[model samples]
Target: MEDSNGSGRGPTVQDVAARAGVSISAVSRAFTPGASISKKTKERVFDAANALGYTPNLVARSLATHRSGIVGLVMGDIRNPYYPEVVDALSRRLATHGFRTMLTTVWGDITVDDVAPSLVQSRVDGAIIASIADADRLGELLYKNGAAVMLFNRSAATSDKLSSVRCENVEGGRSVANYLLDKGFSRLAYIAGVEHIYTTQEREAGFVGRLMERGVQLFAREHGDYTYKGGFDAALRLATADTRPEAIFCANDITAIGAIDGVRAAGLRVPEDISIVGFDDIELASWPPYGLTTVRQDKAALIESCVDVLVEQIRSGQRTRHIQLVPVSIVERTSVR
Candidate 1:
């Protein structure tokens, strides 16, 4: 039997249905998950499908179900070691649930606006926006187009259209502050990530707020822009200043690692001259060279929660907003005195 295309390519669903002595809808239902079809008919359809070497076309199935079975993972900086871990775990989890991940990187010349249309066109059932500086527009576009959108590791203040799963950034910051203060470091400095991002603002607020509560003030603040070079430069400047801080808290692990090198370049010893702490305990944080005292965001818990929320939204065809905050804890190491 010829395919619908009449190219004699191979056996199609139509041929399978004919060979099984069933309607096309019966064959389709037999292959669909949780679809209601009688056991005898399903067995017949499967036997015919096997004999004809008929494989269901995902594209055609998507057209009929209006679900692409694709989840778009939008990110800005894939270079960060932290994000790669997230991607790996997230992709694996999504696969177990019978979904595929489509990675879309928006950075440098490629803005969110440029990619939003293509993602929508791809008919993605859901999206997880991970670590984008400006995700409001993209989130709005996807939400309006009937796709479930969840912000991973970030939040939007003004937009109520998106769901999010992130760590308790404020609490994490407070923990770091208390840890440093308990170490008897009076003069404390902060190395911030991107200034406009919500994570940066919340973390700084928690850290500084706790410091104020303890009758102390932030000694200095520097912008690291969440980059290695940015962190290094900021640390160098802070270290060379006339009145240097006794301890510095970086926003993330990459920044903290860079700050370590920066302190050494300024001829200072870690925890001996200036105690350093970081957030997000990435794999590199535990290394011997940079045993960073940092706040550990539970990556596994975060991904599990994120996937659960997004999949529920996709399956239910509901865009109910949810914001989940995974708890964070401090990991003590040699970096802090």
Candidate 2:
């Protein structure tokens, strides 16, 4: 019940090591999974630890090994349902690999700079950034702080120093354009997310670029900022215009659902009056009310790639850059004619 120093304090690693007839480092290795130690030594350490009721201090062990066994997950705008699903899958995957998740949300007035210091101070072995306005700055900061950086659902265009896992956004956009054009819709409109973000730019470029190649022009364009209210407002604007588009392609599913409501509120029938399409086939997209046709990104593949890249960097102490682009597919539903 007492430490090696015999000051009446609870048992410490020193007490366990002394009783086990081993060095302090040996005791640490016994507790660390995958550490190099023989079974007999580990059994002795466990028996001594049990007799003395000693438990290794994780914080102290982290200081010695320089591994916090934690991964920071920086997300943006949890209001969108897509991110919650990403969080769930990513957390479970990381747990299976013996690492815990430390979450931080950057939305509204909150910026990455505001949260980066805490994540760095916690000594996270690595970080996975789901969304960020300034990826370059955040990647640099985390990299300098000794944390391997991985961008989830983001491209490495802005920050080549970090690894990334994302879907083929440009191709997804092209597929949407092809679907709408194949339906014989001459007048097509587009709803965009943030103007400067890579995802938005790539999706818009692919959609409009394909349309131009087909000798057609975009009838209208609006910024939805990847939010429900933004989508609603943009749709209302398009609905009341002197000339309305026969079809609308939203950058994401949340926006598409909002656009559908706006179209209905404006007394127009979906598919019958104006066909709609969306990207990122979120769970809500398949609902009877929405039935949104969109591009489906493989969430499982993306999370697996992110975890693999980050864990390798942490274990190897090497900063090897990896940029993975998972394929995307079009999901047809009642929203599209």
Q: Which candidate comes out best when scored by lDDT?
A: 1
TM-score result, candidate 2: 0.88
Clashes of each: 0, 0
* Candidate 2: segments with Cα more than 4 A from true spot: 1-56
Model 2 local distance difference test score: 0.88
Off by over 4 Å in 1: 1-8, 14-55
TM-score of candidate 1 on Cα atoms, chains taken together: 0.88
User: Whole-model Cα lDDT per candidate?
Assistant: 0.89, 0.88
Query: Which residue pairs show backbone clashes in model 2?
Result: none
lDDT of 1 by residue, 1-337 (tens): 6654467798888889999999999999887644678989999999999887888898889998988889999987777788889998999998866688999998778888789889999999999997775797888888988999999988876698899999999999998889889878889999999787788888999999999999999999999988888889999999999999999999899999999999999999997999899999999999999899999999999999999889889988888889989999999999988
Candidate 1, clashing residue pairs? none
User: What range of 10 consecutive residues in model 2 has the weakest lDDT sum?
Assistant: 1-10
lDDT of 2 by residue, 1-337 (tens): 5555578898888788999999988998887744789989999999999888787788877988878888999888888899999999999988866688999998889997899889988998999987678776787789999899999888766566888989999999999888889889999999999786788888999999999999999999999999998888898889879899999999999999999998988998898988889989899999999899889999889989899888888888899889889999999999877
Candidate 1 all-Cα RMSD: 3.6
